[model samples]
Target: MRKIFFSGAVLTASLLLGACSSTDSPAPAPSARASHNAADATFAQQMIPHHQQALEMAKMVPSRSSNPKVVDLASRIDRAQDPEIRQMQGWLSAWGVAATSHSMPGGHEMSGDHSMTGMMSDADMKSLDAAKGPEFDRAWLEMMIKHHQGAVEMAKTELAQGADAGAKALAQRIIDAQQAEIAEMQGLLKQG
Candidate 1:
């Protein structure tokens, strides 16, 4: 009787364990809290060229400016923005979107149908490209401050409307960093 009872108990335990086994279906992927959206795509598209222009301006510093502090600041800007440009580019690629936006009827890109905020006009860039020494330093600082301001504005818009977690975080970083640099530039301007 004891042997029979033990065998029955073992069989029951095995059946219970089999019933508790997990299903073969794969577990669902974790839901992303902040996913891509129109605003996120727009932000990346606008910011890429904006960062590129800043790099262009920074490159001009070494050859054109005499101020050590200004040159150093420009170097910092160039270093910081290069990676950010690549990052934005990666985002565009991952989303399967074009790096450049559709041109408006007037040859402009983006919704405004005019200029992107903080982008220097071709003429303005040309002027900076021509300047040298003190003039170059002054032009570089003033234009960059304006450029940074425009970036901050664009970033703020992203923060307000953007949906992607990564994009929104990047926007906030731009705002914080550029705003601090703007204040530093303003102080430098006051000194000279």
Candidate 2:
């Protein structure tokens, strides 16, 4: 009787330990996947082309604007935005979404939803393209300031409503960096 009771107690203890260990282990494969939703997708899809336009605008500075400070700011925008575009592209690919599917009639245009805020209309872009020298510098600074403000608003929206951890992190980063750049641009505008 004593031997049987001892064995039974040991077995119970082992089973309890095993159960606790299993519960403490990591989650299964399916639950471990990152969470994302429509907002994250929309943010990525809209931002990619928006960033592309910024790059286009930045590229214009080297050839058209002679101001060293304006050129440096444009270069900074180009460098920062290019990597972010690729990052969002990766996120879209991971989500099985097309990055360019949301464009408007023209290959370069954004959909109607993204047309407001920081986005430059086709005519606005054409005007920027046509500008040169101090005209180009002033126009670029003004447009980019508005663009950065738009980006901050979009990022704030994402931080508030987005489901994905990764997307929210990127949104926060964008808000911080773009806000700083906006302040910098405003200072540059004051000088002109």
Candidate 3:
């Protein structure tokens, strides 16, 4: 009777511990994932393609732009935005949301046609692509300035509406960085 009672006590303790451990293991992950809302999802979905367009524009600078400053700006935009694109994509994946298409019928990445603020039209991209030397430099700067403005607008929207802490933090960073870049680009434009 003593042996049986001791074994039963040990089994009960083991079962309780196992139950607690199993329940606790999955708790934090779902809560973390649940913290995001529809606004957060929208920001990620829209911004991914927006960032992709900026990358496409940035890629044009090396061969077409004669200004060293413009080339450097393009390089910086590429470096900063690529990781952000990936980060946003990761967020979408973690949230179990699919990202919006990066390409549409018009050769632009944005889905909403001209409604997405500051996105270059297909014509605008073609014009920029056709330009070279100083013309290319000026066009790239102007277009990039507009692109950054659009990103700033989206980030502002995210900050206002997003529930996820990480997304809000990223939005703040985007506003700061892009505003500084906008100032720099404006100065460059004035220089030209």
Candidate 4:
């Protein structure tokens, strides 16, 4: 009887220990385990090149425009967009998706399903590039206003459809920031 009791007690203790050990590590938090979906991937992929184009347009400003406001705006655009481009690229890398090229075979801009609105055509870009001084300033402001509007539109779509919290947050930030920039550009246009 003593032997049987001792064996039963040991078995009970062992089972309890096994159960406790199995639950030692709690399940991951829901937010920590949150996964991205296709909309998030698409937003990141499309926005990367869109930002690169903005940066390109910004780079042209210091060389072409003399207005202090235009120069400052261009610098701000460069600062804001370069990091965003990298962030989106990182998302694409993590998602295991290839970044889409902005160019096509005929040197035309690739819009990636034509969802990329406000994109400057090669001819439009050439026209902007050829303008100097006040002309460049006006053209840059107008183009950037349109570009920012497109960005806001894209961001709104992401916020509506994207699954990742981080991506959705970024989309909201983009909307707020670009909308402010759009207003500023419009003010600048009105001044000229």
On lDDT, the candidate that comes out on top is: 3
Cα-lDDT of candidate 4: 0.83
Query: How does model 3 score by TM-score?
Result: 0.81
lDDT of each: 0.87, 0.84, 0.87, 0.83
Residue 89 of model 2 has an lDDT of 86
Instruction: Give the residue spans of candidate 1 off by over 4 A.
Output: 1-34, 103-114
Clashing pairs in 1: none
* Predicted candidate 3 versus true structure: per-residue lDDT over 1-192, tens digit per residue: 999999999999999888778845454655547989999999988888888899999999999888899889889999999999999989988888877645567544564446787788878988998999988888888888998999999999999999999999999999999999999999999999
- Give per-model TM-scores: 0.78, 0.81, 0.81, 0.79
Candidate 4 or 3, higher lDDT: 3
Superposing all C-alpha atoms, what RMSD in Å does each candidate have to the true structure? 5.9, 4.1, 4.4, 4.9
User: Which parts of model 4 are misplaced by more than 4 Å?
Assistant: 1-34, 101-115
Residue 37 error, candidate 2, Å: 1.1
List candidate 2 segments past 4 Å from native.
Answer: 1-34, 109-114
Q: Give the per-residue lDDT digits (tens) of candidate 1, residues 55-151.
A: 9899999999999999999999999999998998888887777787865443334433247999888778889999999999999999999999999
Better of 2 and 3 by lDDT: 3
